[model samples]
Target: MSPGLKFIDFSIMPVLLGAGSCRRFLKTRMLRKMTIKHYSSNRRSNSPDNQYSTIAEIKEKMMKSFGLEPGYTTEPKSREELLKYQPKFEDLPARSMQDSFSSAIIPLSTDAVLQDKYINFRGFARLGRLLEDMDLFAAWCCHRHLKVPNLPEGVPLPYSIVTVLVDRIDFTSVSPNGTQDIRLSGHVSWVGSSSMEVVVWLEQVVNEEYQKITRALFLMAARNATNTAAAPVNPIQPANEEEKVILAGGADRKKQRQILSAQSVFKVEPNAEEQSLIYQLYKRTTPVEQTGQQRLLPPNCIWMHDSFQMSTIPSFPEHRNQNNTVFGGFLMRSALEISWATAFLYCKARPQLEHISDISFQKPVSVNSFIKMTAYVVYTKENYLQIMTVAEVLDAYTGSRVTTNAFHYTFSAPDPVTEVLPRSYHDTMWYINGRRKFKASRG
Candidate 1:
């Protein structure tokens, strides 16, 4: 075995068995042993144990293992080239849930060097970094579910799978220790013509039993090779009653998303209850006197304007994906970190992450671009805080800026946090939106 490599047998077959069954079990055990040996040999050849490997180095190696070349752009250089290869728009073969099921084990327990990449200052796993892993795992599951027609050998995939939304990520337990190994498993639960919903679970072994720590739902869209138009993907079929229920839930979520989009504040006016709530909030900051004067601030409330935190990061090539654009996972990690910082400063205590919802990737960020992330505590209820984080890409040449992504996070403060009071119409709309999202997440 490779240095520091430990083989863990997860099988739990009972010892007391009939003679006929015993022979079969012994055969199975021999096959499993051979498989483990082969896997270990591959691991030693591909990725030898290295204590000095940096995260970038490990990530580059991983991309290569996935058949993606680092620093290589697969997109067509010109519109004419993109037009040369037209994508077919035909029905694809239906796939079963089992076909897309996949799982991975991160050997943090045995790999001390690798654990350093994910550990935070407090010796606990960094949730933001874990988000990156989850995003990548979801993309892998999507790829596993898709199957294209006969194409040239050693050619790139004809479709570009991109994460469009993170429906929700719920933390069911406390942050895990860096010493425990992590198991990521999931499958493509539902699919539309060109969109898919992936469900992933993060678990760790506790007393030799796997315990789920987080469950995430991601919405991905498949685009053409050039990423200019939508591309159809294989449909997924349920194999049993359990899978059928899961598929139904995904369909319901899709409808709910459509409804929410239709009722967005930007598309339609707020309902009666929301309007009343906004007026009441306005009154809290307004003085009773009719004379024209400045608004009065509530004793225990903080103005939304004062609860803003901003950070600018220079995007590097190390964070770029195969398309030469910054990876979606890196964007998510950056936004989550900044939002967590904003919440910590606002509440004057360490906030525990409860839910991450409605993360929308509007545009892609190019390598070497400057990303400006702005976060604000938009709403609060009791000890809970709803934060809205916006990421904008700035052009160094034209000095122009464009919004790239928007992320929403809900956190529970150790103590009661000061309410965030809006001062302008735009802030009020954000407050209302945050309130709605927070309520939905809690439910």
Candidate 2:
């Protein structure tokens, strides 16, 4: 038996339900009774038994309840047919923040079976699964905020929502108990003509009070039905003083992102301070008596090239989303797992995840493709280790690869970790980038 199979007891035949059986139960009973109104508030209630429902299941039911379906243009045979369904930005009306507000509940406390699905081997709720939930929930909120006008009956929604970037995910409290109920709530905090910023909160119910565990900021783009062009989304205006502050924060984050992009190492040379730092690192790692020999590594230090871990994964259909591509959440989970492993190998001990930030989804991974993830320990300060993981999709025919995503994670080790030194100019840039992220995450 597989190690994970130990969590399940085959002796309890009634508790073990097949996928078809679970789907039937959800469709017949849960889907028929649950509605968005039931989940509009954060207060716990004697709601119907929905402990078996996943985020995807809940999203599907909610969309159907609202008389909406996955937005796709009917087999556009030509360019003219596709252009006919192109979305118009001028027609979309401005909306208030309250209009897009939403909430969801994962009743892990009441459902042992559901808890089993989210619990990790260490007994904490899996952060990757939570990430998947956040991505789906953010898209759901965006759909709620969108208001496309004048569509005929039986026609699907005229917009396709896609996650473009995860600006930051901060964990205020790590180690969420697997047996506790979790609440997810958020809204469209800011919006442009074609893009929107969603802020989602993950909280665990402790003593009947919701305690925040993680707060995530996701950037999503709206596209036309066929996802060929950008689609305009309803603008969001602040309804209260607090909301105004939130909106301003979003604008600041947008501006900050622009600044960072313009200052990327690939775009320009490093400033004097950064150059000085890189030279210092080079000197420290170089041998004083150079006889055309490799420098001896100092005690408690390892080269960044030596601190890498890699894995290859086949993009299975089960991980695909409505867009017929690999789900963003699945990619995030895989990256986290590999990064965690990289940190473990570098530290020679288990490391506790401090936070995750700047997870960028550069491209979509197609089903049946293979993903190659490479993780390296690029920086270490005191007991903190920063791991950077890059995910790329490989072309089977040409044997070339295109990067799909990049992930940065900060973990705390039990003891001071061995220092990771840069060996080349390329590795030096990664080291500097990691240092910047580590400092920002700490602040």
* Top candidate (TM-score): 2
* Model 2 vs truth, CA RMSD: 11.1
lDDT per residue, candidate 1, 17-97, as tens digits? 543343233323433444455666675554322222333444554455334664444452433343333346464778866
Query: Which lDDT tens digits does candidate 2 get at residues 213-327?
Result: 9878899998776567788888776664455666777788899999998987768888899999987876777789666646567778998999999999998767766566788
Give the RMSD in angstroms, all C-alphas superposed, for model 1.
Answer: 7.4
**TM-scores for the candidates:** 0.83, 0.84
Candidate 1 residue spans exceeding 4 A from truth:
1-67, 72-91, 291-293
Query: Which has the greatest lDDT?
Result: 1
Clashing pairs in 2: none
RMSD of each: 7.4, 11.1
Minimal lDDT window, size 10, model 2: 23-32
* Candidate 1 displacement at residue 115 in angstroms: 1.7
The collision pairs in model 1 are none
lDDT (C-alpha) at residue 210 in model 1? 58
